[model samples]
Target: MAKVSINLATGSIQKEEIIVGIDLGTTNSLVAFINPDKNPQVINDTGKGVLVPSVVHFGPAGEITVGNEAREYLVTDPQNTVFSVKRLLGRSYHDIENYKDFFSYKVIDDDSESLVKIKVGDKFYTPIELSSLILKELKARAEHALKTPVNRAVITVPAYFNDSQRQATRDAGKLAGLDVLRIVNEPTAASLAYGIGLNPEETKTIAVYDLGGGTFDVSILQIQNGIFEVLATNGNTFLGGDDFDSAIVDYWIEKNQLNKADIIADNKLAQKLRLKAEEAKRAFAYQSLVNDKIGDIWCTLDRNTFEQLILGKVQETITCCQNALKDAKIEVGQIDEVIMVGGSTRTALVKKMVAEFFGRPVHDEVNPDEVVALGAAIQADVLAGNRSDILLLDVTPLSLGIETMGGLMDVIIPRNSKVPTKAGRQYTTSIDGQVNMKIAVYQGERDLIKENRKLAEFDLKGIPSMPAGFPKVDINFLLNADGILKIQAIELRSGVKQEVEVKPTYGITDDQVEQMLLDSITHAKDDVSQRMLIEARVEGEQMVKQVEGFLRKNSDFVSIAEIADTTKYIDKLNAALTSGDKDAIHKAIDELNEFTRPFAERLMDQAISHAMKGKSIE
Candidate 1:
């Protein structure tokens, strides 16, 4: 890392210092720099001397490629090639189905809860490991290009990535030997990419519509006098251009009458089809129609047809924007400007949709794709004291709550609440002689226990076995600046302190991160990948079984699927239960259940029916 001197009094630019901002994206990863003169540039890591493609490939002969070189392998070596790996980064095997159509290799349930292990050429690597490879390659590119070690950087993640995922991202940065200064939200960073360049004291409200290769986010930000406050943000970490590309592929498949086989059945065909779809999508962004012939089928797709094919998916992306506005409690009309970010936002249809939603045209001053990386660098400047005019106030996207009586979720801190916030819950023993108190932590808005995510569990051990009604414990849940949770429990009577367990769920644990780093270097290639995949698959099955059972038991009220379609996926899952391939199991599990949907309205309807059916004594 290079150090540069700056004049604090006047906020004037000074000498040159090298600080890189890294956008470790799902479908692509890039490193950027802000020179001493405030001239920003994105470093090229390609074979042709450009940005890396964030794709990785493995072969039987210990051969590998990165950047553009590895990207071409999608067309050349389908079975062993991997792309959009960022989708798997910090996500469980259960989350892989959103992009499973594009992954050439298979995913297995690794033993880790937060890890997805890919099996390829008799080997396996967690998405984190693959991410590190890309990050390391980017680091190397930065150092090699600058002829200096690139140790310090800022990384970006989807606005919706939870604390665990964000931590995993930071862990990947450390694995790559980079000092990840901060993990900024992709949309927030893009705001800074432009805000920092403008004169201070100007108040601007921007609604960021970010549709990336593998994730979608909508962020509402308020910038005043250079202070960037993220009012509200929401997104689907699993939704992105990848789905649109798959839609195109599905279009080709359906048009060509190739429904005879599963898309995953032929590695080569899946890879080629994805490539063709991506090309057509890119072309259709400008031209009315894209004449693309690259896979098992040939087709000419007009922009109108392409837009219609992805209308639902696109609506889902816009829904995120709508959700963000609702979370912010701000109306769309109040937004000063609408900014678009990410590679997939280039589509004219996307622009049209956004314009219609906001009832205004989007600001296209900054390139949607590179704005995030640029904003990351700007934040890096702020953290390093290069710029003092800016201050950012961010909020946690999910509510923090604890399980209550009857497995109901009692929320402590609501979503979009400012960080470094504190809340406490006073819990008393329920029975006559309750020895231990179980406080299960959860995230999400659902009042039902099973519907929410179990983050961790705290046990108040070594009680005097006193009467349950007499014993009391106060559990304090505090969220720090980094959005990491810390919990503490104090016994009111005895004054004895119970252990505070800040254990994380749904993402890689700290121990796993440390172990992964060592294993990446020492483990035999094929074995590690195999182990990770198996673990991922099993967990995926677990998720499937739980959600599927819930769906079947309450079939009448589900907004999820038509009865026939729902049963079909369930049958497919049943068929895959015996399959040894963890990836397939995981993929099947995820495809069946996704989104924060309110399932089986009949549950509520049943409650009301029961109440109504009981005749009033009056």
Candidate 2:
């Protein structure tokens, strides 16, 4: 049996669950909580610094290491070490096709819109799984420091993160054995940490300039009546302090006349140079010049040259700030305050440029690396009914979503979202000539639809038949004041529309909701595994059908031998699917794709030739 108490004034939960705030970063991550004195502080367990290196290493015998312990593997065994995984979260292979070389590890690319996966040795892992490992580390750290069970958390993400990315973060937290209370925006959390919007009567418009290790983002925000609204956000996901380090590396490489290819081939030399570059970057902050050496190679840098090297990258952030302000429909003078966040903000150049752009002194009173986490702690405390001075609106207890491909629940309205809200996402068909899409709505916290409760379902018919991934469909969920959910589906290309209304709480009881939440947390691993298997099966089936269609329609252009091989590969894939082994199915899918790619290309060439027949070159 459990107890539940609600605060009538704030509409929050008054319980003993100690929810911590987590700032999961690209280069580092940390967890924080509100101290007994009602002040937020970062957990420094056993004097082991606050920052946890966002790196993981896998041993040969199924052993794993995270944080600082795993960082050494980045140089010793780049193939087994994973870093900067935050950039890959919720992104498809096509989204990062141009930047795949950035990672030293193998990122599997099947030339599809599916979520990206990483391969270390023989096993494959998703970004969500890697991120969960980091979260698990943080959870352990928090529990060790606070001497209490920390099973709930509020995680921060970039303001520009879309629904998919936010959902991915939530899923990672769930996988880490934590109930993700909320997904707070990084800029918003920074504002709270600086006490910029604590006073209910305070009204201000501010800019949060965050430049982390591997990402940069600037957001314009408006705070009124204790409500923070993001006006605009813009930044380059691939631009940040990492770029600065690379710039230094490139400068040294050119100056030393070192072969870039040779440096990449030699791991020790590459790591040595990278470390030296980092040291120079930090030294230039207070010293006029920095001099170092790696064996016989001299690494020398002065502040002037160092600044010049990263000047272009800094200018890019400035441009993004300008664009963010423009999108917010405000001028630099209109901004009340500027907040600096992320370790990169410690650079004098970054501060000076940001100050000059906003015509104000940037706020750096709090530690940039820990600000977001601290703010998250404050939000968690508020949610725990520790404060009544600030009031929060009602929120949904569980996530509401629709059944997507492979019986996966695609959450449209996440748990704890403020009621009377509307959110939507655009989706495309996975099969060609598909005219109807079945919309199965579900309500619960699990990742798989089988574990959730069905509310209602309907079909959006009469879609224009086209190639796969052609027809764009937008799904929207609107929850009203009375908790009535209205789901709408619209096909943008054909102008077709369908909608349905369902009472989510019609037959559901409070005890049932509580059970669902507990089950979601208790069986999180099983739920995620099942979801992944189903997704793999769905993708394999789609690939099998597409390959068969290609062979049938273009038999005249493709070689008979190629057709035979592709057919055999498809049969193997179908067999694997029936066996319910996700890895085996994926392997077969990869083989079939590799064999048919050339055949498809040849067919494409023939079609082009036929279309251009008798046409003038001019």
Candidate with top TM-score is: 2
Worst 10 residues of 2 by lDDT: 5-14
Model 1, range 42-79, lDDT digits (tens) per residue?
Answer: 77643455457888888678877777778877777767
Clashes, model 2: 0
Task: Score every model by TM-score.
Answer: 0.62, 0.94
lDDT of 2 at 177: 97
Write model 2 residue lDDT over 1-618, tens digit each, in one string: 877755332345655767899999999999998865679999887787999999999999979999988998888888899999999999999999999999999998888888998888777788999999999999998887776678899999999888888999999999999999999999999999998888899999999999998889999999999888999999998888878888888888888889999987888888788878888888877798888778777788899998899999999999999999999999999999999999999889999989998898999999999999999999888788788887887898889999988788999999899888999988888777999999999999998898899999999999999998899999999999899999999999999999999988787788998899999999999988888788889989999888788777777877778777777898899999998777787778777887777776776788799999999997
Alpha carbon lDDT at 539, candidate 1: 54
Clash totals for all models, in order? Answer: 18, 0
The parts of candidate 1 lying over 4 Å away from their true place are 1-17, 46-49, 61-64, 74-82, 92-106, 110-124, 196-204, 224-229, 250-270, 291-298, 391-487, 490-618
Report how far residue 403 has shifted in candidate 1, in Å.
24
List residue ranges in candidate 2 displaced over 4 A.
1-15, 428-434, 465-469, 606-618
With candidate 1 superimposed using the best TM-score fit, by how many Å does residue 372's alpha carbon deviate from the native?
0.4
Candidate 2, residue 444: the lDDT equals: 96
